[model samples]
Target: MNVSQTMETEEDFLTRLHIKLYHPQQSCKGLYGMLPLGKRSSHPADVPLRLGRDAQACTYALVDPRVSRKQLALHAYRTAQSPDMLFTIQNLSQRGRLSVNSSALGYLERMDLPDKALLRFGEYEMLITRESGEAMGSFEVEFEVLEMPPSRETCMCVPSVTPVMELRALVPLENDETLCHL
Candidate 1:
């Protein structure tokens, strides 16, 4: 197939990426909500997603005072490295700290995310998972064949060696040439 066709195949396998913010069931007095990133609910997937305690960030509004106005930002898009969507996160909080699976993120630092990455901001924590149709589809197509070189020598001929004296007693050889003396 042509270059465009190859890319189109890869695109079809990629799913749209999004973040899922799951509130601890007991943290909000049993009144909890999960926020999925998208534009329909004012959560723009293409733009930097603003998250924090500010009521203005209705897309991902957190009521906890410990969360800064803009604690974290997420940007999602299709990446050329893999057939699955990738995401990058930016720490926007001044006092709050951000971490992915226990790895701390510095202020304003951006880092690519992996599947099922756990994010923590102050007292809140969320899990990031795929949100598109392809995420649930068969993953067999995502793998590419990798060509590797042979690991050992490939000689086919049997090595030549002198016949032992014990063998000569059982079956006599007329000449050393017949024994493949080389």
Candidate 2:
């Protein structure tokens, strides 16, 4: 189901955000088991942030709420396998309009705004701002559904034997090279 259908109120919106941030399984089908943390920007000048695994190389530019009238951009970097994708969700709360523009994908024009705005594309997660607050409100912004690589292992075997037989095997052998013959 689309987020609009499932999410109706501020509380529901917050709950969905929590689930998308913390519990992946309950949010979407393909994203349930994927990595949720990624490398975050460390520049002191940048807004303090935390990232999920799926957000590698993604950059978020926060417009000062005081300066800008109403717009935010999430500058996301694409991986080598996939072209750079910028998934933008514009929310004009005063006019009550929301739109999504993606670089890899086409545009989702002028979707009517409900109460909040959320956009999810592949591993990318984004939530646009609607109102200012004392403490910055956070939302899971990027998610990448990556298939974990397979792992390998090695094994060795030892036989069960009586202590006497084992002692006999351990005795000094005529030829050192023949010690493994037992």
Candidate 3:
């Protein structure tokens, strides 16, 4: 080898997403055996990460009423300075905004995804992590369709941003209630 020539020390790696959902509203309980709370799954970066209330359309489904049928999607790309993956998140919700790391993303709005992000929407919180390794060459979710574990609340209760909010001055009646987005 010539001393003037520089050898590449970094190996190319495929992008991967590690997604885990939290704050399961009662409506999402039916997803118990299908989409359990805190079940982390790794997905190939080549594929877009989709999430919403529809099981058939969304890659990760949540049945919460406050959630939109097609909530959001994430697409991955590469940069000159990094080998891992960079992502951009698009909000697809018709009724609410997606809060990424405390920043609000309205419908059809797109934002550059950080390596790690805290996504909040409709009483649901999702923690997305970036993972890259030479061994992750295939485009597949880490787990099978039916491998979700039992439903449980593994996350702590904290004030989080939701797409919609309604705070009444007096006790709200079942019939006299109005929803206001904050």
Indicate which candidate wins on TM-score: 3
Order the candidates by TM-score, highest first — what do you get? 3, 1, 2
Q: lDDT by residue for model 1 over 1-182, one digit each (tens)?
A: 77876565533544544444444433454123333324323223456666666657633665565568878877766656655545688888777788876679988998887765667676455555554434423221111111211110111011225356644464434543112222
Report the number of the highest-lDDT candidate.
Answer: 3
For candidate 2, lDDT tens digit of each residue in 15-116?
111112222233454333433444221222123232222233223322122212332233222236632222223332333232232222233233332223
| Per-model lDDT | 0.51, 0.29, 0.60
Q: In candidate 3, what are the lDDT values of residues 1-182, reduced to their tens digit? A: 77646554223344456666555344443643445344445566577778787778887776565678889998777777765556799999978878887689988999998866767776566666666644333332332221221122222122334222323333244432112212
TM-score of each: 0.52, 0.21, 0.59
Which window of ten consecutive residues has the lowest lDDT sum in model 3? 148-157
Order of quality (lDDT): 3, 1, 2
Q: List the residue pairs that clash in candidate 3.
A: none
Give me candidate 1's TM-score against the actual structure. Answer: 0.52
Clashing pairs in 1: 38-43
Which residue runs of candidate 3 sit more than 4 Å off their true CA positions? 1-14, 24-28, 36-44, 134-182
Off by over 4 Å in 2: 1-45, 48-55, 59-115, 118-133, 136-182
Q: After best superposition, candidate 1 residue 128: deviation in angstroms?
A: 1.3
